[model samples]
Target: MSEIRFDLVTGKMVIIAVERAKRPHDFAIAHQEKKGSKDCPFCPRNENMTPPSLVEIKDGQGKWLVRGFTNKFAALNTEVKEIDVPSLYRGEYGYGVAEVIVESPYHDVTFGNLTLEQMKRVFHAIIERYRSIVKDEKIKYVQVFKNFGPRGGASLEHGHWQVIAIPFIPELVNREVEGTQEYIKKERKCPYCEIIEYEREAGVRLIGENEKFVAIAPYASQYPYESWIIPKEHQEKFEEIDEDSLSKFVEILKPLIEKYEKEFEMPPYNIVLHTLPPRDIRNYHWHIEIAPRLTIAAGFELGTGVHINPVSPELAASILKLQNL
Candidate 1:
C-alpha cells in the first residue's frame, strides 16, 4: 500500500508508491567511468594546472594520494569587497571558500576503486580539510559532498569531493536544526539515538553495520536505495571522530558502493555529509546520506517539494542486504 511518511530528523515527507515499484535491477544504469584526458587538471603530473595544494596526503614513497586545493572556478571567493546595494536588492560580498579534494591520483577509477587503506587516507584528507575550513570565523556552514557522475552534477569524471564554506547558514540547514531540536525537546531524547536503537531492534530497514556505525535505508527514504551511514554513538561532529573508529566507517561505505556498482550498474549518486553548522551544534547527530540519482524529480516533486519513491525502504534494505560482500 502507498503511504506518506514524515522524517522526524529532517522534517521532510515522502510518498512510497508501492504500485509503481519495480525490481531492484530495473533501476540499473551503466555509469562507466571515462578515461582521463591529458589536459585533466586532477590527473597526476598536472600539478601546474591547479594552484598548490592547501592540504595533501602522501604515500610512504612520497607520491601524493589525496590533494585539497582552492577551486579554480570557485563559486565563492575569499576576497572581501565592500558593497552598497540599492534598497530593492540586498546582498553582501561573496565572501567564502570553495575547494576540491582529489580523492585519488588515478582519474579512471571512481571512489569505489579506492583500497581500504586508501579510503581511510582520503577521509583523513576530508576531515582535515573540514576541520581547517570550519575554523574560519567568517564561515557559518561548510558542506562536504561528492558528485559521482555527469547526472550527479559532476563536470569532471575524476573521483573527487568538494568543500564549500559559506558566509551564512543555509535555509534548509537552519530548518534541520530547528526541527530536530524541537523533536528532541518533545521526545525528551535524541531522535537519532533512538532511531539507531529502534531500527536495530526492528531490523526491517537495517542494511549493514560495523562496530561503530550502522547503514540503513531510512524509514522515510525519499529515493530508491537511499541509505544513511550513521555513527552508533551520539556524535555531534564528523571530524571529531577518533582515528581507531574511522575504519568502521570506511568498512561499511566501501562495500555499499561496490554493491551499488554490481546491482545498479554504477548509477550516479551523491554522497552528502550532514553535520551541524559551525556555530550551532545543538541536538544534532552527524550522518552520511547516500542519495542515488536513479530517478529524476518531475512536476509533482518539484511542485510540492515531496518525493515519490517507487520502492519502499523495506524492499531497498532487503535488496541491499542480499549482497554477500
Candidate 2:
C-alpha cells in the first residue's frame, strides 16, 4: 500500500511519488461501446436540435464548417439571478454560459479522422468563443475541454467540444493560481516555466516539440501516457499566441495527437486547456493536458487523491517518440 502526497510548501506544489501496490496493467479498465442514432442532434444537418449559432464559420453557400451554440441543458444558466456572498461561506446563483462547439457537419466524423485544416478550425473556434465570453463583465473564467469517446464523458458520439464561461474561478484554477503565486514569491520564478526548461534540458520525458511549443510527459505523471503541451515561451494566456505561433502550435499538436491515437489504438482521452485567470494573465502560464482514459480511479486513488501510474513518463515518451519511426 503505497501513498503519494501532494503539498504546497512555500508556494510550490511539491509531489512526493511513492511506490504503490498496483502494477501498470492493474489500471486498465474494460471499455464499452455506445450504440446510438445515426441522426444525432450534434450532426451538421441536425443543427436545428441545438440553439441558434452564437458564431459559425461558414462556407461559400453559408453552410457551416463549424458552429458554436448554447447548450440546451446548460449546467449554469446565465439568466439566473445573481446573489451576494457574505463572509467565508458565500453563496451565489449559478449564472454562466455553456456552449457547444460542433466540430463538423459529417455525422460520423471523429477528431482523429479530421484533417489538419479541420483541426485548426476547431482550435480557432474555441479561441473565438473564449474571446467573446471574457467580454461579459460577469464572467470570470472560460473553460474549454473535450470528452472523447464514451468513457471520457461524451454523452453524444458526434465530434464536439464544450465551453463554459463561469461567474467564478473554478476551485482547481484557484489552487493553481495560489500555488503559482507562492512559487514566484519563494523562488522568483514560475514553477511551470522552470519545469519547461528542465524538461527541455533533460529530454527524457519529451514527446514532441516545435519552435514555439513542446509536449512532454511530466516528471510525475498521474496517469500512464499522460502529457502536457506548453508554450516554449512563458505566456500566460492562450489567446496571446499570435497567428504565426498559433499555426506552429497547431502543427505540433496534430502529430502528437496522431501519435497517441496510433500508440494506444485510439484510446479514449480527455483534453483540457488551462490558462491564466481572465484578468491575471501576466502572472500565469497556459498549458494543455491530455490524459488518456487508460486507467480507472480505484479506491486508493479516489480516497487519497493519489495516482499510481505503472508506466513511467520516460517509457511513455519513448512510446510516443516511436510514432515518427
Candidate 3:
C-alpha cells in the first residue's frame, strides 16, 4: 500500500486519501475503573463544599439545574493580588481564571446523556461566562474543555467541564492564529471554511451533518477516530454565536456525542472549544474538537510532532456511520 500524505494548499480544499485501513478489532479500547467511596464534592448534595456559584441555571421552581463555581485547587487564584517576577524563566504570578462547570446533579449524566434543551442551556452558560471573563482587561483568551473518564484527565467520577481564562495567549493558540492568518492572507479565505466545504463535497471522512454544522474526521487527524465539529457559518468568536445558530449547533452536537457513546462504547475523550481572542476576530474560526482516548502517547509521538494512527479516518467514519447509534 502507498503511504498517505496531506498537502495543504492556499486556495484549494485538500482531502488526503488513505490507501490502507484497519478493522475495528485491530484497535484496543481502554476501560476505566469506577470511582471509590471518597466523597465527590461535585455531587449536588455536597455543593456547599465547593466555592460559591459564579453563575447558575435555575429551574422553574428556582432549583439549580446547573452551576458554575471557582475551582478550589485553581491554577490561578484571585486572592494573589501582586505577582513579582524578576527573571524570564522564573516567575511568580496568579494571573488566570479557573472555574468548574457542574454539568448535572446526576453523577451518571455525561455529555452524551444531556438532552438538547439542557445542552443548549449549557452552551448559553458557557457564552455568558466567556463574555464576562473577557471584559477583564487582563484576560487574553478563554478556553473551554471537558475531560471525560480517567484516561481523558477526569479526576472526579462526576461529569463536569472546565473553563480557564488566561492573561496571556498560549503558545499553541499563538501558532494556530499565525498559521491561520498566513493561510487567509495567501488564499483570501478561511482555512477552516475551506476544509468544511471540501469535507462536505468529498463525503469520505464525514461522520455527521446537520443544517448548520458538520462533524468530520479530519484528513490529518492526529489521533485515531479524532473528529471536529465546525459551524457552517464563519463565526470567529463563540460568545458571539447568535440564538438561532446556537440552537442549530445543539441540534447537531447532541447526536454526535450520543453516537460516540453508543457506537464507540463510551470511549474516554477530551472535548476542546477553540475560538478567536476576545479582542480579535480577523483570522480565528470557532470549532469543537473531540479527541477520543484510543491510544497512548509513545516516545516517537512525544519526540516528534507527527502521530501514527492505525485506523484511517475514512474507515472509522464508515464504521461509525453503520453503527445504529
Candidate 4:
C-alpha cells in the first residue's frame, strides 16, 4: 500500500511506499569496529588534541565524563567579530561560533549505550554552553546536531554533538518559524502541541510519552524510522528547558535510540535540535528530530523537494513500540 503524507510544519509531501519493507536488510551496515576504535582525539587523556574546553563535566577526582570545546576545523570561523563583506556582493563574513561536545570519555560508547547519568551530564553541558553563547547579540541562531557513523557524515568516530551559532537563521528554520506563527494566528494554538494531541488520539504513530515529552513518528516522515521528540508543554527555546524536563526527555530518548540500533543493525543517523531562534520564543516550539540515513536522495526528490519514504511512520512506530527495549 502507498499513500501521501504532508509535514505539518513545512507542508512538504512524502510518499510512503510500504512495499519497500520487504528488503529490510538493505539499510543495514556491516559490522565495523574501526568506527569506534581507540586513539581518537575526543577520547579521554587526549584533551590537548582539540581546542581548550568551554565546558567540561568532571567527577570527584576531576576526571572528565564530557567536554565541550571549539571545533578545530570549524565551518564558520569565530575570528570575525561581525559581518564585514560588501553589501554589493550580497555576502557576509563567515562569522559564527562552532563547538563540539564529546558525549562520553570512552571511545566505544554511543548514545544508545551511555549510562543515564552520563547522558544527563552531557545535556547539562550543552544547556550551559548554549546559555553562554546566546548572550552574544551578534549570533542569531544556534544549531545543535549529532552525526553518527560514516553514512551520517561523521569525520571522527567519537560520540559527540556539534553546536554551531550563526549570524543568521537558516532557510528551513525560518520557514518552520513562519509556519508555526501562521498556524497560531489562524488556529490560536501551537502546531506541534496540536500534533502531540493528534498523534495520541491516533495512537498508531505514537511510540511513547512521559511527564515531559512525547516521541512520535511524524505523519510525513522523510526517512525510515525517523522520530521526533517533542515536549508536552510549549517551550520556545532549548536553553530555557530545565534539568527536570531534560532528564525526562533523555529517559525516553535513550530507549528509542537503542531500539533503532537493534532493529536496523547500527544504521547511520543524525539528530538535530530545532528550537525558537534567539529572542523569538513565542511563535515556535522546540523539538528533537532524528533522521536515519537509510536511503539516498536522487533526481526526482531533489528536483521536486518531495521525499519518497519507503516506510510509513505508523508502521515504523508499531515496530519500535513492540520492541522490548
The candidate that wins on lDDT is: 4
State the weakest 10-residue window (summed lDDT) of model 2: 1-10
Residue-pair clashes per prediction, in order, are 0, 0, 0, 0
State which candidate, 1 or 4, has the greater lDDT.
Answer: 4
Prediction 1 TM-score vs. true: 0.86
* Best of the candidates, TM-score: 1
Model 3 Cα shift for residue 63 (angstroms): 1.1
* Model 3 CA deviation exceeding 4 Å by range: 1-38, 79-92, 322-325
Off by over 4 Å in 4: 1-38, 81-89, 322-325
TM-score of 2: 0.84
In Å, residue 166's CA in model 4 sits off its true spot by: 0.5
Q: Model 3, range 106-211, lDDT digits (tens) per residue?
A: 7777898898888877877777788888899888888899998888877777878899887667667777788899999999998999999998899899887877
Candidate 4 lDDT tens digits, 112-214: 9998889899889998888899998988889999989888877788899999887777778999999999999999999999999999899999999888888
Off by over 4 Å in 1: 1-35, 84-86, 322-325
TM-score of each: 0.86, 0.84, 0.84, 0.86
Give the runs in model 2 whose Cα sits over 4 Å from its true position: 1-37, 82-91, 322-325
Give model 1 RMSD, 1 decimal: 9.7
